[model samples]
Target: MAFPIRSAVAALCAGLAATLLTTAPARAEKQEHAWTVSAGAHAPRARITLDDSTGTLNLSVTRDGRTVIEPSPVGIVTEQADTSRELRFLHRKNRTVEERYRTKSGKRLDRRVRMHETRLSFATPAGARLDLLVRASADGVAYRYVLPAGHGDVLGETSAFNLPPDARAWLGTYRADNEGQFTEYTAATAPTGEYSDQALFETAGGYTLLAESDLTGTYSGARLAHDNGSGTYRVKLADARVKTDGPLTTPWRAMVTGDLATVTRSTFTDDLAPASKVADTSWIKPGTVLWTWLAGGRPAGQSLAAQKAYVDYAAERNWPYEAVDAGWYFKTDAWDTTDPDWQTDSWMPELTAYARAKGVGIIVWIHQRELDTPEERAQWLPTLERWGVKGVKIDFMDSEAQPTLKWYDAVLADTAAHHLMVDFHGSTIPKGIQRTWPHVMTLEGVAGEEKRNNTAAHLTTLPFTRNVIGSMDFTPGAFQRVGLRPNSDAAEAGLAVAYESGLQMFAGTPESYDARPLARDFLDQLPAAWDDTRLLAGRPGQEAVLARRSGDRWFLGGVYAGAARTAEVPLTIGSGRWLVETIEDGTGGLVRNRKVLRGGDTLTVDVVAGGGFAGIACPWRPGVTTCHR
Candidate 1:
């Protein structure tokens, strides 16, 4: 709360006094006010604006009735509530809304509507610039990408619907979207054995993952996608369960980004109702990070040998955490636990203690469909809170219905209240929820690690597609060999880097890691945490490279789909002086094929394909630790 450029606080305090004292007098202005209080905004860069009443900003966004930006010491509004802070002031400015309307002819309709939306922008604190715009609408919301003209990224969007309030939701409605044109998209729920799926949303040329307990709630089946240039897009969701008084509308959240598998820098707002239904909004993280996951389902009843094996493998590698998969004690039958009386935490102490000792936290698994109701959630949440668990990897978004979407959101918020992180398996794509709730961590709404038989192109393209929505925990473990076609360990290392998951689930076994010490080098270079990240080179399915930094050490890893290809990686790897670099040529087998001794005085390299690469660069120091931001 560095004093906002003036004796602004003193003046605000005075205004606050006036506001508090005068509240009983005239009911304050019946409108919202314009809020311009931040000098600090982070970026991949975009310009954003919200128009409730033009210049006279009327809607006062408050947390607990007080306006606070995330991580706080910041305010949603810079000035105190005053006579000047009304719609009269907001009316002073004007902006255009970007959208499309419809009619019965299956074409763009000649129509228009004035939307009073709020503007939320993040000024990138001098790194990779990101800019975005947010617009709230009647049915749902739409986000437009600005700042960089060429960026057309697609991210996943997911929601839960009218789940009797007792159930939790791990969603895969994970939708994807872009700025320029639509892209072919996929989710964890898509029926396999298909070329491309049909668009789910019948209104526009878009799709959704509409899962529900019953079929009545569906406006239509989930929107599958096709020919969507990049990947499939999850534009918006309309939960049918929580009916609005006047019209059917989208959820309170929406997001957009640069590409399917690139970094998501811009985020927008979609909530505009007089009173929002999203009260349990506490668990959301405001920014995105590299998140990974590990499953602990089998570890619960296993011999201590298996438990230690799981823990030690993750611990020694510094892989941050693991998701305790379902069946900790026993599996629930097909009964949807709409009541809270069902106990889901039988092995809490044993598993949690096991994870804590290994220095790896557990993201316990839950089946929202099984315990699918608010009462059940209310019943189970308190118990989970008592378990000392770090997060929950919710599963099985079985259908795409409006009520189901709302149920999913409620579950996310509920999980958040218990201070739990999330990894959505059998889910959708990663949308930009990471910006709103950083704790949402990685989502497995796509064809992630769970299904091992996916093609190479699928693996390669995922980096560019699924990554844009922030971190994705696709459960990327791969110790098992694919077929023996003269064998290639190339993908193992590359996928890890290219996958860009903040909370990564290491793909191989400890024995495998040790067998190929080069793999260890890759692990040693991996950051369990990060301050910044950059998508270096290539695109989805073809080739992709990403570099992230933690303090002085930088971790650069990339995966290429097929045979060898040349890639030039340019990173503003901080303004530093460095000569020479070390890289792991491949994993699974020992041989560090590539070494730097040549005109190593300079930076940059030509990396190969089917082969992932990683390195830690530093100021050439002898017998010294590497220090590079």
Candidate 2:
């Protein structure tokens, strides 16, 4: 189901044009000066209310008869005029959008999304047109602003997420690199500070995750912040303003809602993004990669023999790639290399050639400064391609401003031209960029394995918050415990399946992984990309259990942060019996077992405190007693 990028874009344009020409004024329910737009023609669905009773437009959201978002201001602020309020409603149009697409790598390879869209048109005091586009699906709600045919500098946005005062939230403070832990707080008790776009809330009605999507280089990235003791998180742009010429459409302000399962499995982010821009995507492949920096420091990474050993390890385990982290170009202090003789003297060419001979690819790391411009990218990227390098891991971006985001777009397009895959480190959280550029495999925005202070609760919370948005390069699979509240060996193994990353980087040293044979064997057989995914059972911060399928095999993983407990996992994914193999934390170490179970049968797994479990199930056949890797 590989879609040619041109055809996909054409189809999308055709759909939008048709919607604009054929859609009529929507017949929404009106009470006084308020209009209600229901997600679907049913109860227990998401709803958005537009109120102008006070001579100003305000937006609110509800789910199943419970208020999720209170009345909040919604509009855009431009240099020419302030459209935030005092706007008169013009007309409204409603349409249904159904799209089916396939991804290069994600929780689900094939994705089908259906959303009801409503466009509410308004006019400023001076007759300038503004359109507030709202979209709703079973899993969430999103809204954006469209200033059609006329724009100047967008000063800021007045859109805000006013949550219920009693709701509990898990929020991450705003950082350029987005490498920080999420703190839990109640809406009233939450500190007033800049927060990431992706925030999770447990409301009385259900779970809600606030996020953004379809963020392009034309707009500066945004964060959420509020006054002291206020539950209204207003949108704050990274830069002061974004200049535009003819037309402008801001990124979507999305709120994913429902139960934990619904929140975890929602594809709302990608649903709002544009289709792929690369026409020939057959060269992009996602798989496991051995990273050198976390396993051993720069010294080990600099040594040619050590790199050769890692290449051998990846080759023997049937992995696709091995990543060489920083310090490959210069010894220390100097981040860039301008000396031409270094190319012949450096070991990268030799290493890449040798790795290629062993059926493995090399991914080299570079500082953001090295490829910050077109001339720099043109100078270095081709040399790496000629050296048989398969990918580039760009690091130290550390900003999401409009110019930086534009640089990212340029880098992706340039790297795609060179037929190279991309992994962004020291970067901002993913905002559906992978949907547009499928070659962008993974992004390191979370406090991942490199941050040894990560907790078991952090691992459990990721599948619901950060990872839900897109592919997360958490770099899981570390057998050795280095962090405070360190996870057990089984939990480390389970992370390989629990976390979704297109390019999963194992952070354990070869010796450490070899000592733990069971975990190592599981990593040897694990698939980096999945065809299907399901949340079996779990909650945020306490535990998480996920089942992902690739081909005919099913892989199940669970992680718990609380006290030791027995997790009863029902094998109810498919329709037949299965041959199951499981590994769990034992009193001595890891315990492995094999059994046969039906679709409805349950497998009881005993996990130690700060521990977890991993299992593989194969569809049963006559005379096949053991599940094959």
Candidate 3:
């Protein structure tokens, strides 16, 4: 192991010496000396002040002299001791880091970040030493606590986000699906008993989004709870399942404060996570998959002929993955695995071999309960890996408790070791797992296409909420619209582009795609990863024009509900001419058009109520004015 840097260690050593050698009389004067640190640009300054004598740390963020995060108390609590009281001052250090890297999947193709960091060293009265790290960037501020090598098991930690008493928050309660409707609550009216892991607060100055990041195997997942009429939010760790003996670090409890766009665009969760654990990630391929669940239940889905049909469909579009959803290994009574007539020993090899011949990978689905024990996971995961299964979609986890959180880590660790990809269904929202384990292609946390029908308005709000933090298995590309929703082929095509996911599983069956030939081009061009993303024009619940680029090709689309709307989407497709192809809603299905577009061209798109449009722009010859319709 690399030795700790001498400079950083020196600071900590000095801090420990100060606390050990100082006389009791000097504590009175030390209380008055506040250690102040600042970060971010000149406009929006983020300041953290630590009172060494009292062991209290307070954070305040400001934009143009207006307060964003009020003087909020920032500290941690454990069964052994509370940092706010018994923690004594140790050495401190400051540093800066700059990075530019590509995201494996998500809205943006690449990320460029610069962070200024301050590390405060502290030693408990019991002689335990720890470090509290605060990192400030142009986007927001994030802080986390680090326990030294010999620190014992932890009870809990805190990242209290104390907003103004009058501030209102958009709170999402815990549920099986992360798509739980967000309700507004005032600080005075605390959401007691509500399970809110990610909370977005609307303060007087701007928005403050609080979330946890990089929770792997070391720590338990946490949610926030509040007392009625107190307006004070505290961190509630998942049960008492988490225990650490060696060196351990808690997840980063990030508090991002900014305007709507600034807050939504920040990728702090991904930034806080370590690099990819899968070194040779060449085998990790992400693409649209064909799911059999949305078509019907196992009666219509779980047969050899039915799966082969889906594989045939995947081959036609050159899609890499095809999911044989739940009940593939013999149908059980009423979706319960208790009385199972298992068929994996007999038929799985035949199906996998068949798919391999057609150059299509198979993903099987199983219930999380079935793999609750490590022995069960070890036995089945390796067997599936040997059978040439590319991935597994484990569902019905449905719990945010501490043990459940630990189970997720255990499953991912085993799956990654075997080079098998994973997709979590009926599970909690993603929290930077993709960066830590790139093999975790996607997670089904949102109210995806599996619901049969969804409004364009709800689709618009996702970009700012669910999709911002992590991968969403929002299974797009459903050509059919439910009820009297005025669905159009153009809108269906647009969704395939607008939404972000590592695994872009299409809900439409093979018959649906073959029925509408006009959408084939747009659907086939959908990318599993992107180089950059630009949110052209949008609000939370109105309309959205999202543009994403992969390589030199750019895909743009817009979705809206209610009344008809129009948007002028600007393009910066480098310094070259290109051919812009658009599929728009028409009287009969979709209307296709192609035109010559330059680097600074703006494409105007109009769609009726509950409608959308998708277009693609690719490089073209300078003299190409006449094109196919």
Candidate topping lDDT: 2
Clashing pairs in 3: 11-91, 15-90, 15-91, 109-530, 109-531, 109-532
Order of models, best lDDT first: 2, 3, 1
Ranking by TM-score: 2, 3, 1
Question: lDDT by residue for model 1 over 86-124, one digit each (tens)?
Answer: 222212233544543221110011223334343433322
**Where does candidate 2 stray beyond 4 Å?**
1-33, 38-54, 332-338, 482-485
| Model 2 root mean square deviation, Cα atoms | 10.9
Candidate 2 per-residue lDDT, tens place, 498-596, comes to 998888888888887888888888888888689888888778888888989999999988889879888887776888889888888877888898888
TM-score of each: 0.57, 0.92, 0.85
Candidate 2 has a TM-score of 0.92
Query: Which candidate, 1 or 3, would have the higher lDDT against the true structure?
Result: 3
What's the true lDDT of residue 66 in model 3? Answer: 71
The total number of steric clashes, by the backbone 3 Å criterion, in model 1 comes to 118
Indicate the residue-level lDDT of 525 in model 1.
62
* Runs in model 1 lying further than 4 Å from the true structure: 1-243, 247-305, 318-320, 331-345, 484-490, 579-582, 586-588, 593-609, 621-629
Residue 518, candidate 2: alpha-carbon lDDT: 87
Tell me how far the alpha carbon of residue 6 in candidate 3 is from the true structure, in angstroms, after superposition: 52
Using lDDT as the yardstick, the better of models 2 and 3 is 2
